[model samples]
Target: MAEDVQINWGKVKNIFESVTERMGQNPDRPAIGAPKAKVRVIKERLFEAKAEGHTFQIDEPVERGGNGLAPSPMAYFTAGAAACLTSHITQSAGFLETHYTSLEVEATVLWDNRRKFSIADLAQASLGIIYNIHMESDEPEDKLIALLKHAEDGCYASDVVRNETPLRAHLIVNGDEMYVHKNGAEIPDVPAGPTFGDNPTGMSKDEIAAKKRDGG
Candidate 1:
């Protein structure tokens, strides 16, 4: 449990699926189905959320006519990439008994949608990560390459994106958390949040919206 970690990067692959697993229901008691998570675009590109607790918020800069108060949702692209890279580095560094002084992950969304530069059409994935890394002492170039490959191979997100996986997302206009799976149970909409388009003062809007918009 030291700061340095170097483990088989593939080992961490299971982490993502486990963290994002959804509750699968058996309608027919002994029925079977897939073990996939659900995603719902809460409000335009403004917010794309899921029950798994990860959120992708679309923000615009001042020049884009938006308030610029929020960070661009695509920026989370970098964040997600970094988190995955960090996990790989941590696991790898631990097993290798090495560490990185600085780790910087960057993701550049390449917009290839000639029809319309829509965020949904744009691709989001980890471009790469630079780890100012080294062993307790200097290591050979070949050894470093091996470690880098380990990090690359350990990136589960990359694998999933490179090899497109079947996507299934459920959109709930007004789903409620109290009755997420309960039929005929729906949450109500109170007054709008504090300001325009914002949630209430002390209430979780996602929870509210999940109830009010997506309905319970």
Candidate 2:
């Protein structure tokens, strides 16, 4: 059992059962959620955003014409994906009783101006942002692989990244509606990337016990 994952296994099963029962009773009960961010531009390439009562600053690098006081917009996007994967892994490990110590997920996003900002290329490039995810864990090989598969399949962030979602743009000029762009397309979803191979660390509990006994 990993100490860092402090989920109460005793209640997890009950909670899951309750959720299942509720869904069965009310099939149309919607799971509602929305994320709101209020961004105020401070200067060219710099802005401050408030979301969920938390405030954060975002800025481009000096070369991009900002003070570089904080992470770029892309950094936040990548970080969100990493955070989602980490949370799912922790929850799955606890729920499934998968033995493990520590777990870490690193996400790298690849995108270029041509692919992201160019109107001509946007329609053609299905993969505006390609990401690679790497996982590190000390659990048994099979257990780790199972955990990874579960997280990959169920993580909302990864699913959003992998699938394409449309965006609607509303443009206003002098308080008058200037344009409304309904052009929307799905964004590519992220896929499983490289991972540490089977028993990469070879630190399973039984192996550790044997090593201690051998004392060689």
Candidate 3:
């Protein structure tokens, strides 16, 4: 008698969970690429997040004193994961000799909490990216999947919060004026410090820009 072959999805999911979900960021607080300007999020996370006039939405959850006007941290986890997957596939596919057309990562974040946007008692129940590929090309499915595995291995943001990567950011303020970074580096070569709101705690954007110029 020939035995029936059945692929267990649970086992597959378990494997992904066991391996990728446990690998934390390579270097905690590693410097990642930042935008010179804000870029619009072309996609949304379960209608909780949306693109609006070229900005990634940031809002506190209902419990935290926000109007729930924005998506929560779990939502961000989903968004960042999907975004990383798309970017990784686009960049790594061709180099690995795979014909891939498009890819979209859809994540379902089920936070085990009554408090919205809270990480406490939270969970990511679903995670996977569907690749619309042109696998009819020379590369085999096994090889393409292997490349994807490798690329996912390098995605840090997805692993950062999930694996609890160590991070910290210190601030130095003067009279409600936010301080710029000073590492004894040359002008135009120095890294940018954190940015603040238009009318932040103290100085206006212009005042802050001027302060940067004066090395204040």
Cα TM-score per model: 0.46, 0.68, 0.42
Q: Each model's number of backbone clashes?
A: 28, 11, 0
Q: Comparing 1 and 2 by TM-score, which wins?
A: 2
Tens-place lDDT per residue, model 3, 1-216, is 223323333443443444333333333432333334332333342133334225455555667655566776556666766777656554455445554433445545443343444544444423334333232335676887787786677665555545534433335466564645453333232245643211223455698789779865
Cα error, candidate 2, residue 165 (Å): 0.9
- Model 1 ranges with Cα > 4 A deviation: 1-58, 117-137, 173-216
Model-by-model lDDT, in order?
A: 0.48, 0.66, 0.49
lDDT of 2 by residue, 135-192 (tens): 4456688887897788778777888767665766668789999997765674333233
Output the better candidate (1/3) by lDDT.
3
Q: Give candidate 1's total backbone clashes.
A: 28
List residue ranges in candidate 3 displaced over 4 A: 1-56, 59-73, 114-139, 169-216
| Clash count, predicted structure 2 | 11
Q: Comparing 1 and 2 by lDDT, which wins?
A: 2
Scored by lDDT, model 1 comes in at 0.48
Instruction: Report the lDDT tens digits of candidate 1 across residue range 1-216.
Output: 235434443434433233223212323322122222344444443444444355444556766655555576556555666567656656565455454434444554443444254545434433444334333435566665665677768776565555545543334556733323423334333333243112212245577677667543
Q: What is the C-alpha RMSD of each candidate to the true structure, in Å?
A: 14.1, 13.4, 16.2
Residue pairs whose backbone atoms clash in candidate 3? none
Worst 10 residues of 3 by lDDT: 194-203
Residue 88, candidate 2: Cα error in Å is: 1.3
